[model samples]
Target: MTISLNKTIAYTKNWKPTFWIALVLGVLLSLLLITLEPFDNSNSFSNKYFILSGYTLCILIPVLLVHPIENYFYTLQTNRWYIINEILYVVSTLFIIFLFSFLYHFYVVSGLSSFTFASIWDFIKDYGVPFIPIVVPLWVYLRSKYGVIEVPLYDKENHKKRTSVTITGNNKSETLTIFESDFVFARAQQNYVDIYFNTESGMQQKTFRSTLSNIMKQLPTAWQVHRSYLVNLDYLTAVEGNARKRFMKISKTEETIPISQIYYRALGKRLSNSPQELQN
Candidate 1:
């Protein structure tokens, strides 16, 4: 269905996981190459292990180098990530590794004199075609292990119901009581927390001399999406950017609060299960 096709799935742009995945894949592929003795590698002057190491580098280097470029494009289409995008990423990564493998064969496995258009075509049929069957399953496994699913938003009539809540500070008289639904977000600025909320007149801010954690205690419904920011899920409008970098937009505010990677998945789950719809 069109709805299923358009549904967004989580995409991780964090380099730490990417590095580990590439390293593990490289090691596995190297081991396979050693076991199968694929290609006429015995004829080469280099040691078998040494040539295998070159192939490992061919896989590792391309993934590390190409990921940043992929991340750049992912950021441009942040919340729109779908299965098709992930498929493109996998295909592009394989193509890059294929090119690197071709170069490795041309310089290390075969001499410069052997280079020819037909040689490249032969390499594809001999090497690239076989690589896909092995690599595609690995990619599929990695994606299923790491990917997050988005939940459908359902209507809730009481989402905007106002309930009076009081928030206090470290010092006496530094206190505020407002309708919970009107609270937008709070930012920790050194010793003070700047609270933004909606008012009959417009948006208003109240500075409380308290730590973010202390403020969070009073506002149980609020979530700390970043180290310095606490947001009311009721006001959350959209989440933008990939897993590496993300921002949260609040209703009635122009400022976009940064969402830390540590809290990204939790936030996604919270929004996905929330009574209100999360606008992309």
Candidate 2:
């Protein structure tokens, strides 16, 4: 839990911490419920507080369980029903929350009272409506304190599209093929295209007698940022400076790609400064 407090997890690192946090949240919620007085008008203030705490425990239990399940959701293999796993997580969480709400009302508030969907729905609304003002700040604080490095839940096959492109020479014999993800950027250099790409060691370049336009057809993550330069948006980090001049920075490189006034506006509109430039 300490290792990933900022990021959402199923449970806290220790039972003590979980108990303490839950107690604090539960006390605050009890206060809120006391303020609202959304219970049987016949119940006294003391009884109302007691009843609200039971409902609060129900909310906390499901929250603790759901976060951990969601945290590990990205590990599901894409070929083996990733979408189904995601759906199950959501459905199961909702079911648990609703079940707990109904049970709390049945056992504690009203003995075998006629439980209806409307009653459970009202409980859900009261429980979840304060999420923005309450939970969002808590979420941000946890993330800032624990360094919540969010792992994107994109399908493995979708995130890294491993495509093989066959590059052919004028002679029928010579050919070279490359994966699209490795490509960084390409520049139009005289008659040949200077293809810059990422490597295990560092940035590497290859000269191919190919037009930038032709090479771009194979690169889905690439965009024509300038007349001379085509940038692979996947590795792109930021665009700095004013409209007069701008610098485009890519991941793992101190050097910045120049964006000309000719293409600066277009590049700004088409690509974001974030690394997930190709993300939908």
Candidate 3:
């Protein structure tokens, strides 16, 4: 499931110093471009401040939009595998910046008539031409942000919170909202994960199409018992069975949770030090 920044907390959680650094660079570069007039095009003394304002807007607009996109992009980057997420984030954001720049050129700077494909290409190129020399330093500064902490600062001790996690069913539009604690366990069934949780009536389940490994890291209180199952540590009642086949059971749910040989010992150690409060 793809998660996005919903509020200011999410923004602060995802943002880094590098973003502010990028904005500062954007401002300084705008100033430099306005002062030097590198290309030496027809610009008299009277129009200097006007040219400065245009350059400042051009940098500020894209910088503003790109950073927010980065907030969501980093969420994807944290949840998914690096190679896949990086490619998607980069390509998507580049297009976003281009689209923003295009609109800025059309509606703000030049008229809609001058906003053809050729003009847009020329406009982006004009922006890039000045950026070529400083690109390396910008890359070096921004690269550090790629590995920024996704852990939210709000709950310093425990990142876990009662959050609304949406589960989209077979149909893309069909969805259900479940509280984090109510969710019990998930099992991999073919191309989807069959998620099980508790309700006032009884235990309910929903099918979510996603890799188990990906979802494993996403759930804060969940732990993998077998290759197929991820159980909530909060609901876990006791570990049962013998050396041949160890299994775990949860409160109010009699469903047999198998503890495979791989995760068997690790599960024991984890539960050993687990807070007794959750066991209540």
Model 2 agreement with the true structure over 164-190: per-residue lDDT tens digits = 666553345534566777677888776
What does the lDDT read for residue 19 in candidate 1?
A: 79
Model 3 Cα lDDT, one tens digit per residue, 148-196: 3222212213424567676664567646677777778999887688888
Total backbone collisions for each predicted model: 0, 1, 0
Candidate 1 per-residue C-alpha lDDT over 1-280 given as tens digits, one digit per residue, 9 for 90 to 100: 2333323456656787777778778877778777777777455646778777668887789889988887786665532355667778788888788778888878876656557778777887887888678877986677556654322233344446778899999899988899877788999998899998878998899999988767876775566677688887667788899857899887788899998775677668766676566522
Per the 3 Å backbone cut-off, how many clashing residue pairs does candidate 3 have?
0
Give the C-alpha miss distance for residue 103 in model 2, angstroms.
Answer: 2.8
Among all windows of ten consecutive residues in candidate 2, which has the lowest summed lDDT? 1-10
Better of 1 and 3 by lDDT: 1
lDDT head-to-head 1 vs 2, winner:
1
Q: How close is each model in CA RMSD to the real structure?
A: 15.7, 13.4, 10.6
Q: Give the backbone clash total of model 1.
A: 0
The estimated TM-scores of all candidates read: 0.53, 0.42, 0.41
Better of 2 and 3 by TM-score: 2
